[model samples]
Target: MNFVKRAGMSLGARKPRTAALLAIFVVLCTLLLGGFLLQSAAARQEADAQRTVGVDVTVRKKGLTPALADRIGAADPVHRYSPEVPVRAEARGFTPLVADVPAPEGDGAGQREQGPLAVTGVRDLGMLLPFSYGSTKTTEGRGITPEDAGRNVAVIEQRLAAGNHLGVGDTVHARSADGRREVALKIVGIFQDPRRDQPGWAPPHELPGNTLYVPVRTAQTLGTGPAKVTEAVYKVGSPDRAGQLHAAAERILGGGGFDFRVNDKAYRDQVRPVQRVGAFAGLIVWVITLAGALVLGLIVTLQIRERRAELGVLLSLGEKKWKLIGQHAVEVAAVALPAVALAALAGSLAGQHAGDALLGRQGDEPVTAAGAPDTVTAPPAVRVEPAAVGKVAGIGLGISLVSTVVPGLGILRLHPRSLLTDSE
Candidate 1:
């Protein structure tokens, strides 16, 4: 019989077995493809999140000084820089007074007295550490603009405003450490520090408390001499170049009188957790896929053994063993081709759903430790693209062909005459 006819006859005669094997192939292929897609999506998402947050380096100094901050900015390695000088001050003309209210003859009632408030001198609160309080803009009323640096203007927290009943354009008196010098400041704005929620050493404020913003220059003038800056903040050229820029800053400020610190170090430190999770997931998927392939190969081998009798008859009829082997091979190919195609399709859909679950469908929901959100959107359709489908199909086909071909070699040694006589 011609090869084509022989293969067709063999396939037609064992419809049930062929169908069962084809179903097995489909299930195995689907599992492998799904696992691969899930791993790829997870790794890509994690890498993207890490790059977005960038890295941070901190430089600390013995004392606040603008000289060192300027030197770091002028250095080649530093990409961007901002400076801060924090100082304490006391509110003047805001003394606590107790009052006595009219009461019955036997009743004595006196209001408790309040104490003077301590505050900090902030240069440009929003520039170095930009943050907002509820709905208030950090620089709303009048931030520390260059023009305001030398003037007696200030920005205080909302809690301070409420406690003192202070509003924009309200004049308040603040004094230096020795109470030797007092300056009048106009309330230009109100803001909250980002670190207000954190514990440990924090400025004396909770979102709306005693913290205040004044031009760094003005604060220096009010307290110490020479309007110096203790800390610096910079806007980087690009995240990719952050490392190089940081190195440059360190080199420039290494022995300078001040220390440089990056404000975003905490955010950068969070990337480790996301990376660990992604690596663990990838390892698990690979293990499961290899196990499935082994189980599938064993099942295919067993099915071939069960059909040995039929194969022997064909061999006794003067059928070229190679041709008979080809027949069985063709039957497997016919089933496996369509099975893989269907599996690939199913895998693409499964991957899309799994990706959504792992990464989230919302663009604004945080996906990484740095608080960066997953911005990946689902494609309009869940079907695998043609390119990806072709690659996966090629791999599946290769695996199936190998599984079918390797065992066919045993058929070549069977003697049809000996098998027939034994049957009688």
Candidate 2:
């Protein structure tokens, strides 16, 4: 009889044993496919997190102008950009917040010198650390955005707005100390600052309640000299891209007094855990494969010993020893195909739940937008794919061959006489 036909007959004759072996094969294949799926999912999530969470690059110099900031912000690697320019301005209409501490009894003596309110210009106020970190919140209307770049708009602290009886759409006036440059700003938002007047006597511009956020252009208009920014912040998709942004800045601003600081805390917080999950999944795959091979190999060896009478009968009929081994390999490999199919189905159904159990729930950090409302994106999810199935099938075949062929070697060394005598 053909070896393949004989192998099929043997499996049909031993239905109970075949069913038990088939059950074992399915469990091994399921775990192998699950591991592959997990590793693939973790890699995909890490890449997505890097792009969404991103890294912040801060460039600071003595006289960083708006023009230079714009040039750096225009880099391809930069996802979002903001330039900060701070200026002191005296309130024209309302009584601004003054320091509670007693004024120095000297040149600028006890004469109750009301200081100017703090005016900070930015391309996007939402991207400010205070607002993004939740230290300051927009309690009314909206905050200054990139669209307000050329417009005369402002977002004031709640206390300052309350003191002046200002609401959204109200106009406020401020002037330079010299009274030479004046700016009329329309209030678009009101933010709450959890700060009080300090004990030390300082200018109003340095006071927390007197702080106001406005478009970078509006603040620049109040200045006399060339328009300059205190510092510029650019956000890139990944920490590795910080070098690209730095190179772009070097090309435009040159390597001088400017320094670049990269903040990758968000990236580290988010991506590192996913990387560890992937590594653990890879380890699981190797360990499972080896264990499955050893277990199946031992089972095949014992089955061969019990089938000595059958093997002796086949050898007495002049069947080739290699064909005897080939029959056993064919039986094991036949069981592997259905096992892989069942594994693929199980993975497609339960992969996501397994991934979540392993990775746990990861919270997405909120991202403050330039001109749009605050948004948070959902994290990437685990999924089963054809590639993972194919890998499991390939590994299953290798396991079957190793389990059957190595033990089958013992049969090849015995002659037909010794085989029949041993059976007797």
Candidate 3:
């Protein structure tokens, strides 16, 4: 009989065993394709969300100016940029007794309990409200509004209020580090910092008790320099525009030593959790693939022993050993072809479901306008793509070949005399 006919007959005769092996291959392919597709989708979603990660450009030695901020605000793709002055101001009529202040820049450096508090004054003090991540809002009263600017108004952190025995309708008076500037402002609201991380690891100023939020005008009154604000914040739709933003900033600042800090942490935070998931999923897919290959190899190896008599008969008729190996390889490919098709269908559906589950969670910002209201929704999601299908099909074929070839080697070495003689 021809090798193709022989392979067909052998597969047809063991109907139950063929079905069992076919099911296993299908499952293996399905899991492999599904995992790969889901991983790719997750990575793509992270990349898309990356566009929303805001950027910060700080003027270390040279303070930011209102004219530069206005220019940045008018720039294309730059949304909701703000000018701010971060200053060290001493709190009068109150003393900080808290011991949680972090070590300062230099070795063993830290603020004395009697030291001045770090204050940030912004044009949009409300933007620093709790609604924004890396920000906080009032737990008691309310966040500072635009009306607070050009007035003696401040938003006190809850910790600051607790330490000072103050609340809404109270006052927080402070003098700038140079003592040349001083401001006494009424506290219209009290806020609580997220303080998610331990104070030891966070930036010293980010600590709850250490900061005070006020109007940009108030900051200017408390800070002495040619420039009014210290830094300018820009949300330029996507991080890929870093170059454009840098160039624009340089043009606005007349090309000095200004520094731009890209805040890609939004994307990082979204992806970091899923990265661990992707790595573990990738490892599991490979392990399962290897196990499936070994199982298929063993099944093929055992088939050689069972069909020894038939194989010997063919060998006696002058059939080459390679022909026998080719027959076995052909059979594995036949089984895998069907499995790959079925897995493609099953895996695509399963993978999309998994991808949807991984895309976002609570507190995640959508890839749209910065500070966009809920009315502006994210677009529809893509379930699957052509590249994913091609990858699965190609890998499935590779798996079929590898699994067949490994055990086909053992089968080809069988001696015809031994095969014909072995009755069992």
Between candidates 1 and 2, the one scoring higher on TM-score is 2
The C-alpha TM-scores of every prediction are: 0.56, 0.81, 0.58
Model 1 is weakest, by summed lDDT over 10 consecutive residues, at 107-116
As for TM-score, the candidate ahead, 1 or 3, is 3
The residue pairs in collision within model 2 are none
- Candidate 1 lDDT over residue span 1-424, tens digit each: 6877766776688888777877877876676566556556655654554343434334556554666666665665444344666655666765321122333343222111111233444433434434311223453365565456568888776656766787888888877655667788888876544443333322232223666677666566556445545556653433445566667655755665544444444334434444554575566546645654465556656766776666668776677878866766666677767886897778766767765665454333332221111233332123455655565566566666666566767767778875465445
Model 3 TM-score, 2 decimals: 0.58
- Predict model 2's lDDT versus the native: 0.83
In order, the Cα lDDT scores of the candidates are 0.56, 0.83, 0.65
Instruction: State which candidate, 2 or 3, has the greater TM-score.
Output: 2
TM-score sort, best first: 2, 3, 1
Compose the digit string of candidate 3's lDDT tens values, residues 14-67. Answer: 888789878988888877777676577556554554444444333332656766
